[model samples]
Target: EMALASDIGVMVTTDPSQAYAEPLHAWLFGEDQGRYLIAVPEGGVDPILRAAAGTGVPVRRIGTTGGAVITVNGQGAVSVAELKALHENWLPVYMA
Candidate 1:
């Protein structure tokens, strides 16, 4: 819904750091009331960082969000779901 609800189109970025890695991935594939994209401008996170400093809040600006879904303008790239699914598969084993 992030895309459909937003007044304007959104863009998202990918961060290599563990802090934002998984979260970004989840956001990418989300649909029907989930985050789609965000255009985080350069130095946009500076203010938030300053506020969180010394408060034990760690923060890093990875990418300035902008552009189409495939072009999020992120720094650290995450493989797409199709490619990821091809690389691995899991099944649970139960013991009685």
Candidate 2:
């Protein structure tokens, strides 16, 4: 629920069934219509990526981004310097 509410939804779950539900719902309802799915190590292997990708949802392995750079459609890759800037600037505001 919290994930869906955020500007970016980051879901981490071991249960394949539970993992599939959110993305599937988003896919079906057009909730995250053009949103990109940035998957971490575990989430990188999620079936939802494939499903969402098939439906034109962009998905990418961006764990290395450290949840910094915001991407859409996974087409262009954000540079580490850009991510570092985001982290340095935003982390203090959000984390505090």
The TM-score values for the models, in the order shown, are: 0.35, 0.24
Error of 2 at 95 (Å): 18
RMSD of candidate 1 to true structure, Å: 10.7
lDDT of 2 by residue, 1-96 (tens): 222233342323233333454563454335454554443455556786688788986555423233423333443445445555565679688978
Off by over 4 Å in 2: 1-44, 64-96
Cα lDDT over the full model 2:
0.46
Candidate 1 lDDT tens digits, 47-90 = 76687585866555534323333235534343344333433443
Clashing pairs in 2: none
Give per-candidate clash totals: 4, 0
Best by lDDT, which number? 2
Off by over 4 Å in 1: 17-24, 27-44, 65-70, 73-96
Candidate 1, residue 83: how far the Cα is off, in Å: 21
Candidate 2, residue 1: Cα displacement in angstroms equals: 15
Superposed on all Cα atoms, the candidates' RMSDs to the truth, in angstroms, are 10.7, 12.3
